[model samples]
Target chain A: MRITIDEDKCCGAGQCVLAAPEVFDQRDEDGVVVLLDAEPPAEQHAAVTEAAQICPAAAIALA
Target chain B: MTEAPAAPAPALTTRRAPGCPFDPPPVTQELREQAPVTRVSLWNGSTAWLVTRHEEQVALLRDPRISADSRHSGYPTVSASFEATRAHNRTFITMDEPEHNAQRRRFTGDFTIKRMQALRPRIERIITDLLDAMEQAGPPADLVTDFALPLPSLVICELLGVPYEDHDFFQRCSAVMIDTRSAPEAALAASQELLDYLEKLVEFKAEQPGDDLLSRLAEQYLLTGESTVDECAKQARLLLIAGHETTANMIALGTCALLQHPDQLAAVRDGSPQRVAGAVEELLRYLTITHMGRRRVAVADIEVGGQLIRAGEAVICANDLANRDPEVFADPDRLDVDRAARAHLAFGSGPHQCLGQNLARIELQLAYPALLRRFPGLRLDRPLEELPFRTDMAVYGLHELPLSW
Candidate 1:
């Protein structure tokens, strides 16, 4: 599965980071979220889906 | 240079404590009978105007003349540090439009009525799970500790993608963030601790990525560098703190209000889900749990309702008063459980209205029925007078609602 992010729609609400921290980390200073990988591995399916569900901004897309 | 017979310092026209300090003042009736805009004293020892009439409140709340940011309003605060003040100010609740709109737009997906309703099953399971635990623990249970408080905390934790078990730590840390007497330094330290904790959690989510709000925030906004990491952590903190604390109080107090009125409770319990939804609206209006008014600083001298508000003056738009305005509601205190609750300002009006209103409504709708049905014989363990009403906290609610079935 591949995860695509819309940077403009993301306001660093951090639901994604909380859902799948392994694939996402927001910065320490200003809190802009950082995606470690554009497409996470298969092992991250559950957490990735969880992220998609919880993103209040609908900034995450999975295929 | 002392003058004899000095004029009175500014004071709010407060009626005798309407049950408790946490409770709303008797402005609705006065506004309905007398002037819509009347002068009142603030708890901070300053004078301000209370907009009570339904129409006036709605217009004033929506007007551009009022500002939602407390800092600009000379709004009296108890936080220790300016930064701590800023931390609590992370969410758009304190913002005006454009900025507020931009911020809210990001989180709008999870807050739609449809979205909140879709989460009904999960909400039900959560409530049942908590009630089951409460039942296992037996009677004389502290509803606040066992169910009321933990339910929203857990739900918000899940929604935010933070670990629910961390409720205790965050709850404690969140305290100084909202304590009425917390100095700026103390509040900032507490806020920083939470931010630090959340930052680490974000790292974990980044590496793993989950379906939680935090993971997506990291993946989308933070990862792209549109906003800073601290900004992202602050956003997470805002959700966890405001979303959890406010809803926790609503459940506890709303439950207590229902238990106080058996007829109303029975109506909601026996009626269809639609009826319960109506009952929830009425309860939100009647209770208006977030009694603290939204503070606004008058940027330019302007006359509102009938009062002339001066530039730089701080005013609190009391939602509780707006909820009970006789002009809008008939027998506002009767708890009919079917009043035109849509007219109430509990979720507020204008651009700063609660983004979580949809979620809160679903929580209440799902909670009231599940609660009454699961514990049909549920009753308050102590009299209302003896119950610890939270006056010191930012959000007013019962501290520990002891109940037995």
Candidate 2:
């Protein structure tokens, strides 16, 4: 699965990081989304999907 | 435009049913089931759209047309104190985006999940120390005062560089600030006192910057001209109050809820760290402490859940009700510790979603398990019915939880 995040739209709630820590992180400066893995392993897909679905800002997208 | 319904709108303020302190008011559940989007009369006799379903609340709260600016004439407030002191207590939470985003980002870095995770050891230490003190004092301790309240208050004080010794003064002030029934003058005085205290602290931080949030705000915003001293202080005051009161209540109320359900309480007490974390989410969903619905105003006409909310109409997204929406959680009312309840609207949704949620989550995750583990035979000293719940306050919680181990 491919993952993408719109940093501009991220409110830094860190839901994505909480859901899939391996695939996402927040910038240390402003807590904006910091994509750690563009293509995570199969085991992480479900959590990544949940992250995208529950993101308050709808900032994360998956393909 | 959709024609108005014939029935008289119910008042927004509804009491929880007797003997059902954990449940939302029966009226709220009925509305969520029958009419998810409908008008409700506010305290001031003005009407606002009350959105209760989870899906509709998520949709409407995320819509840019629904404004969070409390200054808007149509914005619904929970109390006279809230309305009268609205101007004095204005912070980023009450502002619309671009501006809101700008101000909120200033402190989000310090509250990120990773940053908060790094504070876990420190938080755990604080919890252990409090429990040690509570144990030393023996049984029949007021957990609200001795444990729950101080845990978060101390953590927030340390994080913001505020002296924990003055908790009595600030917590007293915070009580009036959150009390829905507080007089307008009392609320204003409380808010002014906190703002003034924080303003002085910001000036002190500017002169002697420390490794804390307030110091960073002082160095980056107050000194750099990015924000005025008053603006910095207001934000600080917001964090100080928001950081402590909500989490403190959650600690106290979550404990009460868990103790009532032995199965859930045991799950939290004996569960692994992972299980404890999941239980925290369920507790947050089950006893959503922010009982006062998130207030907003419609800046443009919008249709949600088959109802037309006209421009300038106020809106109250009853998140506490939405968290209990059956569509989102199976058997929504049950407090199952193992449930995947992370999607709950306890922290709200959209851009204005709580910035301190990560920190709050960490605090709770550490607090609940540590608390139960420390006191294996923990039980409520008073009957649940006799407990004084903070229904009079905007944030729902027990005013005092007398616990005996």
RMSD of each: 11.2, 1.1
Cα lDDT tens digits for candidate 1, B1-405: 121114543344333264543346554345446566655565556656656666666666666777766556365332234325753555676676558767766676666544566788898899999989888888989888887778888888888899988888999888777766677678777888999999888877777889988898888887888767777888888888877888888888888888878999999888898788788879888888766655566776667776777777766677787787766788776788876575567777655667677678788888878888888999988877788876656777877899989
Write down the worst ten-residue block by lDDT for model 2 chain A: A1-10
What are the runs in model 2 whose C-alpha is more than 4 Å off? Answer: none
Count clashing residue pairs in model 2. Answer: 0
Best by DockQ: 2
Q: Relative to the true structure, how large is the alpha-carbon lDDT of every model?
A: 0.72, 0.90
Residues B138-187, model 2: lDDT tens digits: 99899899988999899999999999999999999999998988899999
Cα lDDT of model 2 by residue, A1-63, tens digit: 998888877899999988988888889989999998999999999999999988998899899
* Model 2 alpha-carbon miss at residue B17, Å: 0.4
Q: Give Cα distance to truth, residue B12, candidate 1, Å.
A: 5.3
Question: Which ten-residue region of model 1 chain B has the weakest summed lDDT?
Answer: B1-10
Q: What's the lDDT for residue B402 in model 2? A: 93
TM-score of each: 0.80, 0.98
